[model samples]
Target: MHHISNPSILYFGTPVVLVGTTNSDQTYNLAPISSAFWLGYRCMIGIAAHSKTTENILRSGECVLNLPSVDQVEAVDRLALLTGTSPVPAGKLAKGYSYEADKFKKAGVTPLESNLVKAPRVLECPVHLEARFVSIHPLGAETGIDQIRSVALELKVVRVHLAGSILSDANPDHVDPNKWKPLIMSFQHFYGLGSQLQPAKLASVPERLYRTFDTESAKATH
Candidate 1:
């Protein structure tokens, strides 16, 4: 049973990324965003044209993408309605957005200095990626709406920082899937990954081996 209806928002579950950018005064600005994806060492992030994060990234040419776990959803939600822009755009104001000068303090997240980038990383997040901004491409103009316009930024990963708990001691390159629980945003609501139902047919690993690693990771996390 499926019904086709136009929806207002298209955010149907994506990992939340806390983007850290440098402000004009050399201070760091942390903004929560879900419009991001990675392929190999390159990543693309979609940011609103009026956002301060977009402005900072364009000017600074660097940023840090912090991946928060499901347990940090509360902190991510606290930053939802806040904007780095001081005046608070009229459209954002109508949607209950407010000016937040110190977003890191308001969200109760600690800032850690990054070695490769000027933008600081969120200490609470398990994974931190230091990236160098490459370029920006304007998108979403077919709707004939100015407010809906966004810029897609291309970034090259320079360094990756991960928490030991989320990594596998046996293999440094692999992340223990069972130990990492990324927070997902489904139509503006927060969610965590559910229990595995079945093994994918296309999966390269054998079922028995997959189960073994899954069980081991779960035990290690506990």
Candidate 2:
């Protein structure tokens, strides 16, 4: 067997996020990106300069992050192909396929008015985050690409909206782990998800727990 290693590669394994923003003219824009995560209660996003999404965000300072489930994967992938900066095909503005206008309809995604932000949320996404722009940082392009400079944003989470199906009326705060399905992206590939492992418990008998923990074979077997 042969192995090779590289350090200067972009190998971040993260979930795909669709950022919804409104243009200066008050038109909606959907940007498919993979550079966002939650830090405590704060949601931070890393965008790139020269992107339509970044431009609209800089102007409006408000946006919504929509987390789509696996069922909406195909539609969300289409949005990634169409750019708001590009010209729309012939004349489909009324039907909602315009380049500068909202593409939610074209992508078969539904929108609902946000509580605090002007940007709307994707009704199909299981998780929705209402965010306020806190800060933006500019970093130069990675490989001399004029349109690929990096922009980091710090956002405050105003509210979190989760699907009712994920919560149990019996224990609301404790979401059904099985129901919290996330789409994982790896090396430009999308996968549904894996099983959820149960957390270590304190109620187990000490001898049994010790044997499980002490044996090296237990780790290898799993």
Candidate that would win on TM-score: 1
Give lDDT tens digits, candidate 1, residues 1-222.
Answer: 999989999998889999999999988789999988986667899888779999999889999999999989999999998998989999899999998989999999999998778999999999998888898877876766664668899998777788998987787656778789998888989899987678767677643454333233323221
Error of 2 at 25 (Å): 1.6
Kindly give the stretch of ten consecutive residues in candidate 1 with the minimal lDDT sum.
213-222
How do the residues 91-154 of candidate 2 rate in per-residue lDDT, one tens digit apiece? 3344365363558877888888887789878998888887778887666655565655678888
Best by lDDT: 1
Give the C-alpha miss distance for residue 57 in model 1, angstroms.
Answer: 0.3
Clashes of each: 0, 0
After TM-score superposition, the amount by which residue 172's alpha carbon in candidate 1 deviates from its true location, in angstroms, is: 2.1
